[model samples]
Target: MTTIDKHKPILVTGGTGYLASWIIKQLLDEGLSVHTTVRQKKHKTKYQHLLDAAKQSPGKLKIFEADLLIDHSFQEAMTGCELVTHTASPFKITGIKNADKELVQPALQGTRNVLFSANDSDSVKRIVLTSSIVAMVGDTIDIQNLNHGVMTEKSWNTTSSVNHQPYPYSKTLAEKEAWRIASEQNRWDLVVINPGFILGPSLSKRTDSTSISLMRQLLSGKFKMGVPDGDQAVVDVRDVAKAHILAGLTASANGRHLAAAHQKDFLAIAEVIRKKHPRYPLPEKVLPKWLFKFVGPLMGFSRKYVERNIGYDFVFDNSYIQQDLGLKFRPFETTIEDHFKQLVNDGLIPDKRS
Candidate 1:
């Protein structure tokens, strides 16, 4: 593996995303120039925050227009960069009219486009991919069949399909395609960071992210009575961003690393919020599994998903990331509190009691 030049700018795909924005901020803070790709250059409002951040740091920021499905769109931005971080992917959980067109194809083809550009770029030597834990296990119940009942980097999701759990299926296919492409070439090494449900203050005020939406739902009394007893491996957005930078810079970081910090259910997350803001109507009770199975459809959850995930614990072995990257994660309580405070401060969530 070739050592990446700190002086040269690095390429970060989907720079306006919640996770990508944090990664860009850290890169600029470190005095490293960044080349970021956006879907439209005309939408200056989307990436103005990145530019503002660059003004405060020694690093410079450049924005380029790129599309995930369009071949060679990322080539110009990737030129002269020794490392590339691919964080762009469709992440919608519901209202997906066409899973193949919306989630699966874009994710799979986006990976292809980015890696293809990396292959064409002579300066590129390593790639840090933003994969998710869904690629490791489709549902929480899948963990029960494992030897230790915990997911690791070696685990691969096999239960998800285009029809059911389409988001997880998309991630699984995308990461698998990335690894397959990386194996065919020797010029650049591939490093994948599989983070769990990411939550933290977003760099932008955008509420389009699922994390922000979920937090809003919690604070808005949508689940004041109770929430489904389903566990999700969780990680802070900042930690996931740091993992990408470390994965790109560290020579030994070649394989997949799980970046999750804690394993907690929806109700546990609500409890964390309630502890900080007692005024908010955060759910304290865990809804029964059978109740979830009955009402999950109203909330856009499939029967198969509810059957396989509700009441099951989602655990992961995150020791590899800590041992390999020397990463110290912030406590889950802090993450949840900070996230809730950000939303309230930004006026994104209603502070008044129902």
Candidate 2:
């Protein structure tokens, strides 16, 4: 019932990010005017890919500077925007020394700041918030207690804390805060796209993305001896971007939409890479949980995380995004294939030809 005004600009936060870059590209491909934000205008060089994406597309692009911690930083970009895809949030699992300061505050406050801008805007009617599957379940083991051993939109991460699983904890706090704020408003509706560990081609060559870093570590034989039993609910980044657009434009789309495709472990990921480059030193097996439990702490993961997540299978029910948004997920093989190809093309990871 809802049809977005194509002429009206859509605002996308975190334009230079791996996932956000894909979202912005799709919007431009659709010939929709997109206004995007980065931390500062001086960093415009990082967004040349976005500029290039718009070159052949009919869509118009505008760049703005905004900060997550600064109040009203997103207001100017969001002005006259009927849909604001708030994709600006930190995602990091390793090297987090201060959870609250480094992860939680920015996510919580960035969401708050964006909502504040929306509340003041007369044009914004809906917000498609980018949340994660981690916000639904604290650990892979938590899904075992679900009704059908599948994580759903109804799930809430109760196990994560600022100390343990702080990244998930930050997403949980931010999504919870969003719901709290939306309850007090009437003019706008909030739609959440809760995707899993997003994988696939990134438009930019930046190495800061958590997914990119993980991909690099895997392809570089960092875990050639063996990878942990950790599993991921994989979803294509392109599909995730489509979910945001559908959630914004589809009038009937409501509540949280789980945007994942498959439930596979780290070994499965390595196997997919091996198909293209078998000679590369890819993991052939998973390390024993008992052994990983001891070495987990040495590799940035806490002993508690090892106990709870390792040797567990995490399954998710993605029926909502598919049925509601009419989203068709890309194959896992395609996701990994395109991702590795992009990395190799950019020399982010050298292509080894034997």
Candidate 3:
């Protein structure tokens, strides 16, 4: 285990992101000074909340400007930091016009740039990467090929590319690149956290994250007709943040940790919200698979892909995270309720059914 004093000033990339913000909060609460990276230092006003938190806590906060694609952009921020948490990665399921330029290139290049900086930084001891469960298995259909019913850290996403589930493909390649680089050197040990769909209260008012956008769609009646017959291995955002810190400080922590809760389908998620906040118009029915055949294509989803994925079950063995990092999960119901309450309080959602 890492001693409190041995933990040097940490550097967190993508500090403004929905998940990374919580990681910063936990670290600061422990009285550890953190140096966070942003695209522009002039965006200092962007992280005023973090500054405010630092003032009340015993820790300190420093800001630096770094771009994922730009070479040597992270050098200054990485200097003398003992630990680095690389959390910045593009996450968009739609509106992507170019797969290479938009998804793949940046992810691969970003891993290289950050790890190269870690190699040069003498003070850095470990690099913890924020990966996703997407890297563990590509799609629900992949379960047929495995002997075991569930996915574990030993599994790798073998069937993913820009043509299908491109987001998962990007994460697979980026994480592979991280391991490839780490194997060549001995300066910094690498640890990766592969979390499933993250959901919880937001640290800011921004609604750009896909998970948050899903909540917005639910409240706005975007899918009032019905929802696709799909399920997600959900994990709370705060739990994921706690896992990251635990992995960083734990001495024997040296591999991937799958931070996920029990699997739940769309109807399951909607049911939970409906119970807590009956005012919200949560989706009630599962759209017919045949109807999805027509509507899926219009929504930029391949009909064949939907047919293969819909109504399938995918399980994850989270014992590794529990036993190794000593992670305790928040009840899935609690996370759902917390996020829904925050939504109503923020005025982004109404207290009555739409």
Candidate 4:
């Protein structure tokens, strides 16, 4: 691993996101100057926590306005930074009306915008990209096709497209685009963190992402009846953030890293939440897979998605991240509990456990 120049500011795009927030926090905590980009600089309330963190920590923080879809918008923030971390991308799973415009374009073009900006910058030496495990396997059933039932860094999501699992499709294209751009240049190298479903406390109070939305449903009794039967590869938000830092600064950090910690079903997650708030009627069992296959369409998932995803086992190989980054995962129990309590502390989840 090479040394990090603390004097050089590291750029982290999409500073307001669930994962990006933690990334920014760790960067600041390490006393490194951080240059972060938001869609708009006027939304002070949206990023006030970051300013607060900067004030309290030893690191200097500067916020710049950037639009992911806008060409060269990230150039100002990325200029003169030796390390650039791209964590900005739209992550909506449901309510997508136009897949190409809403998901694919932004995810793909955003990477284009950032990596191009990196190319324009002379000081850049390394870049860390935030990618999802979905980009490795389109759906859980796709896992069955893997040689050893484990997803490695070599896995590429070939099953997603504009019509099916478009979110994963977007991520797949975006990461590929990053690597493709990196290959054309030798000045800067690329490192990718392919994390599974990230959980744990979010620094911001936003519930925009699917992960936060799922946690809300689990705690707010939306899934009190039951969640669809499925197993998901899961990881802590903090661990993912640390992986980004490691990848950005470590000279030896090359290629993609599968950064998930464990694989667990929905019932196991609910059981963790229910240990303290059992009266909230958290899911005690999985909703029958056969039933969800029919109900999935109404919930916005395609019938094929339900058929392929529901009731499928989740198995992952996260050794790449563990071995290269020397990153350790937080306990699954801590991940669930800390996330649940954050929602409660922020009043996003009410005291309806009675």
Candidate 5:
């Protein structure tokens, strides 16, 4: 493992994100100075928690303004930093008017802009990017084509595009672009952490990302009618953040690491939550696939998509992350329990069990 010099500031893009905030916190705990990038410096309220963390930690925290669409915006942040953690990729499943403009361009171009600056910086040794399981396999049905029914780091997403699986496609292209840029020059090594459906408490109250927003829906009684039958790979936000830090400092770590715990469907989550807080409007049953096929389109899901995916089994070979990075995963049940507690603590849901 490469020894991290505490004096050198590590750059963390999208520092305000749920996962990135945890990464910043862990680095601070290690007495490593952190340089974080956000779009606005004027938003002090958004970063005050970081200041709180810094005060209690041995590390120093510095924030700089940077935009993904703007060229060279991250240059100042990347300058003089020995390590970079790029977790700023856009993730939105709905309300996107232009998928290419909003999702594709920012993700691919952001990697270029950040890596270009990192290459120019003399101190940088490695970069850790926050990728998603979406980049590993498009849907649960992808297991059928796999040799061992496990989605590993060796796999690449083959079922995404602007027209379909747009979010996954953006991640795949962005990671590929990062590799392409890294190969063109040997200045820095790249490590990608591909987590699946990250859950647990979010530092910020914002519900922009799909995971946090899904939590909002659960607490808001949106799924009280019936939970979707679709399954997903799950991971904790804290674990994902820790993997990023481990990947950065671990010298032997390279390529992609799948950071997921297990495969579970929406009904599984509802069952857990329902058991914890019976008074909450948690769904008691799974919606039928036929219903999903007929009504899913009205809810914005494509009919073809509903027919092909959902209500299936898929596996993620997270063994490489534990073996290569020497990291351990928290149980999936613990993630759900902690996530529910956070929702209640944040007032997103009331303490019904009490």
Candidate 6:
């Protein structure tokens, strides 16, 4: 069992990020002091939401500037922290002109840098890593070969490479590096929260998050024509945040815990949104696999990706998270409904019907 100090301020990297923001809020709501990192210290506009949240909570919030690739950049922020949640990593599926430079190096180096700092810090006892289900399975087709046709913590993505599915490749490599570093030391225990396609509201209005961008595309009529028949394990952002807190504080929590709530297709997600808000131009049908395969290249997806992922169903075993962390996921309808409502309220997505 690992010992954690509730009074000592906990450190959370990437505080302004979509998932990290919610994690910070949860920690503050519990009246726990939070120390978080951002890329720029002077960019208050980017992180003002966090400051505002801090004002409303009883817990104190301290902001620090740290870079993912810089060695020991996190040491100052981690000085008195017993628990560290590393959530900073690059996540992009497309517009990759150079995969090794854009995705892999940052992720691998960032993990190394953070773990190295954790090793240097005598106060740190537990580290909760924010990993993705993509690290378990590279593509939906890979699920067909699994023993029970479901992905679990035992799975490792073997098909992803720098040339194909670079985002997943980066996550897989980063997580492996974290494990390798953690195994060499006994001072701190490492717990990993591997969430599925995280979808929900954001604390910031920034449209850069992959989740936010995807949600915007869906509600903005980008998929009004049709969506591919692809299935993915979905989880709410709030539940994922709660999982991190549980992993960090729970003495018995260990190893990789998958945090997916449901497995559904794009059309199913749209249906949920359409049910709540029928005015949006949401896609009502799934595009034929062959049609997507032919036109996918034009939309930045490689032929191999379409071949391996389209028209396939991917599922994840979330029993470990529920059993270990005692997590109860929100309904998919609630996640989708809340997410669209937030976007509309924030004016991130103007009502096209208007």
* 1-354: candidate 2 lDDT, tens digit per residue: 445676899999999998889899999999999999999788767999999999979899999999999999999999989999999999889888898999999999999999999999989988999998889999889989998888889999999999889999999999999999999988888999998988999998899998899899998888887988867889889999999999999989999999999888888888888876887778888899888888888889888898888888878788888888999988899999899889999999987945
Clashing pairs in 1: none
Candidate 3, 8-121: lDDT as tens digits: 788889888999888999899998989999897777667776777788888788988999999999999988788889999999777778887899889999999999998888
* Candidate 5 colliding pairs: none
Model 5 CA deviation exceeding 4 Å by range: 1-3
Taken over the whole model, the C-alpha lDDT of each candidate is: 0.91, 0.90, 0.86, 0.88, 0.84, 0.93
Query: Candidate 3's C-alpha lDDT?
Result: 0.86
RMSD of each: 1.4, 1.1, 1.8, 1.2, 1.5, 1.1
Alpha carbon deviation, residue 170, candidate 6 (Å): 0.6
Clashing pairs in 3: none
Task: Kindly list the per-residue Cα lDDT of model 4 for residues 121-209, writing each as its tens digit.
Answer: 88888889999898999988988899787788988999999999999999999999898999999888889999899989989888887
Backbone Cα, N, C clashes tallied per candidate? 0, 0, 0, 0, 0, 0
Measured against the true structure, the TM-scores of the candidates, in listed sequence, are 0.97, 0.98, 0.95, 0.97, 0.96, 0.98
> What TM-score quantifies how close candidate 5 is to the native fold?
0.96
lDDT of 1 by residue, 86-172 (tens): 999999898889999999999999999999988889999999999999999998899988868889999999999999999999999
* Candidate 6 per-residue lDDT over residues 1-354, each given as its tens digit: 986989999999999999999999999999999999999989999999999999999989999999997999999999999999999999899899999999999999999999999999999999999989999999999998997898999999999999999999999999999999999999999999999999989989999998889888988899998999978899999999999999999999989999899998888888987775788888988988888988999999988999999988987788889999999999999998888888988999986433
lDDT of 6: 0.93
Candidate order, lDDT descending: 6, 1, 2, 4, 3, 5
Candidate 5 lDDT: 0.84
Residue 247 in candidate 2 has what lDDT? Answer: 92
Better TM-score candidate (1, 5): 1
Q: Say which prediction, candidate 1 or candidate 4, comes out ahead on lDDT.
A: 1
Clashes of 1: 0
lDDT score of residue 95 within candidate 4: 89
